[model samples]
Target: MSVPVAMLMAWFCEMLLLNSRSNQSVFRYSASFR
Candidate 1:
């Protein structure tokens, strides 16, 4: 694969993992306010 593509794949994995945690935080905070 090209270098840029490889870099993007790595970044995507990081974004997915990071967003999963952030999503959970948002979900919990919203639930508490209800």
Candidate 2:
């Protein structure tokens, strides 16, 4: 509910989304090489 807490949560979620997107791209790249 606090401003800092909300900002932290948003940052965390963004990091998670970025990580998953990178992982997916890596997976696809590797699959293409197979």
Candidate 3:
């Protein structure tokens, strides 16, 4: 694969992981308030 393509894929994966992590944290925070 090309260098740029690999870099793009890596960035995309990182963003997805970060989003999921944030979502989990939000859910946990809300659960704690209940």
lDDT of 3 at 1: 69
Model 1 C-alpha lDDT versus the unseen true structure: 0.62
For candidate 3, the clash count comes to 0
Name the regions of candidate 2 deviating beyond 4 angstroms. Answer: 22-34
Worst lDDT window (10 residues) for model 2?
25-34
lDDT of 3 by residue, 15-34 (tens): 76577865665555434533
Query: What is the lDDT, from 0 to 100, of the residue 7 in candidate 2?
Result: 79
* lDDT of candidate 1 over 1-34, digit per residue (tens): 6889877766765576577865665555434533
Listed in order, each prediction's TM-score against the native is 0.54, 0.59, 0.59
The window of 10 residues in a row where model 1 has the poorest summed lDDT is 25-34
* Alpha-carbon runs more than 4 Å astray in model 3: 22-34
**Candidate 3, residue 6: lDDT:** 70
Cα-based lDDT for every prediction = 0.62, 0.62, 0.62
Q: List the residue pairs that clash in candidate 1.
A: none
